[model samples]
Target chain A: MNITLAQARQVVAGALAAGRAASYKPLTVVVLDSGGHVVAVEREDGASTKRFEIAHAKAHGAVALGLGSRALMARAEQQPYFIAAVTQTVGALVPVPGGVLVRDADGGLLGAVGVTGDTSDHDELAALAGIEAAGLVGQPD
Target chain B: MNITLAQARQVVAGALAAGRAASYKPLTVVVLDSGGHVVAVEREDGASTKRFEIAHAKAHGAVALGLGSRALMARAEQQPYFIAAVTQTVGALVPVPGGVLVRDADGGLLGAVGVTGDTSDHDELAALAGIEAAGLVGQPD
Candidate 1:
């Protein structure tokens, strides 16, 4: 269930190409290893300076929690206390949109990828394309 | 080194509860499993829809890379191409603030969580609370 840096790089490259094909604005992307370690990272031109932070935060959340950011949103609605405690304990977590989990063909977690720049949905699409290019599977909602 | 769904739920609940005590605005919280999969999620009332996406992306990036979103942000400043490529690959990834990694007492990989709505600092505080509530250690950048 380990992920190679080369594979992560390929995934990011594929995703970037897809974003370009869709005429998306500048963006930032990141990949993390199975141990929740950074394998590769990139930021597009014209992306907001803060986007780097945003992208990392979202990606970090996915790998740390092993779930999409959207799912977290639903939980927050039901319980505010738990969410607050988590925020206080984990300084890096941001429960927003635009992050996805990365898994291997055998359903093993290889890592995760996150994108920022355009809408969350658009970002998810670009990530999906990148995962597909890498011959991997993106978790379905 | 696998995080269970039950653990993820506990972390989210704890964090949200902490936020409410502080009377913070609405928030979005997310938790990821050890394999970087979605385990649990929640969004507080008044939180923008985008918060959910941003929070998850940030957390995903943090755990995937084994670094805090803050560090990832700094790296992005130095490496734009890499970041851009990452955004292209992972649609849900955003390298912003508010993501954290969840680790067990033995420093084993547990999971990650992300929160949004308030300031990045506040969001992080909530995430920390969640991790602690789950009886796990939240990596401090």
Candidate 2:
């Protein structure tokens, strides 16, 4: 499955709009394709300088592992060394709550979206909004 | 002066627009702070898997050296071993023409932008466009 550039834009805009609508701080959002490559990214005004990088890392980790970063975060707690190895393998993987896998209606993996520069819960919520806005399923668990 | 996240997004958007306008193949654009850290990145759909890495390498080389990758290319010709060492020194410094130094109106270094997925000349042009669109200067040399 592929994410068109237009859809990628919608994901970024949707994420930003969700953050704004929720009254959260400015955020950065990123989308990665199935192969764990960036498709699009954006940082809202006043987002921290590192927000974009964090967002990308979270998305990369999720898509590369075929699981949401929240799952990774939980696994990391059980096996720190294994998680570190996974991070090394993925080269920017972040086992955190803000990354969610993007899947099609048929449950085929499309990609992932990540959000940063706010509370982890808020970040996850915005990412879900982004994925849904693009007509994709976001696994929030 | 510090480069704001908002301006970083501008650079990313401008670079992608330049690539589209030039009809270059799908591209990946990246921005790095002077400290060799990611600010923003984007890879167009259908772009090669390595485009984002190559783009980031070029940008890191430019920001770290305080010169365009074109200059680094020329320097590399005179000292091949040194350039290779430089590449190792910088995590992802590709001594090629795709990277351009970013500067402010007062000539203060801000960061750099790199473009991949096209000819070196075309990549340089896109990176320059990104810098210029953000009202930042790109030192092509």
Per lDDT, the best of the predicted structures is 2
Q: Please write out the lDDT profile of model 2 over residues B35-65, one tens digit for every residue.
A: 6666677788778877888988888888887
Clash pairs (backbone) in predicted model 2: none
User: For residue A99, what is the lDDT in candidate 1?
Assistant: 73
Per-residue CA lDDT of model 1 for B91-135, tens digit only, reads: 456666678888888888777888888888888888888888888
Mark the 10 consecutive residues where model 2 chain B has the least summed lDDT: B32-41
Per-residue lDDT tens digits for candidate 2, residues A1-141, read 877767888888888889889899988888888887777777665666678779988888888878899998988999989889977776898788999988889998888898998898889999999888888889855
Residue-wise C-alpha lDDT for candidate 1, range A90-111, written one tens digit per residue? 5465565667788987888887
Residue B13 shift from truth in candidate 1, angstroms? 1.2
Name model 2 segments beyond 4 Å from true: A44-50, A88-90
User: In terms of docking quality, how is candidate 1 classified?
Assistant: incorrect
Tell me the TM-score of each prediction against the true structure. 0.51, 0.89
lDDT scores of the candidates, listed in order: 0.78, 0.84
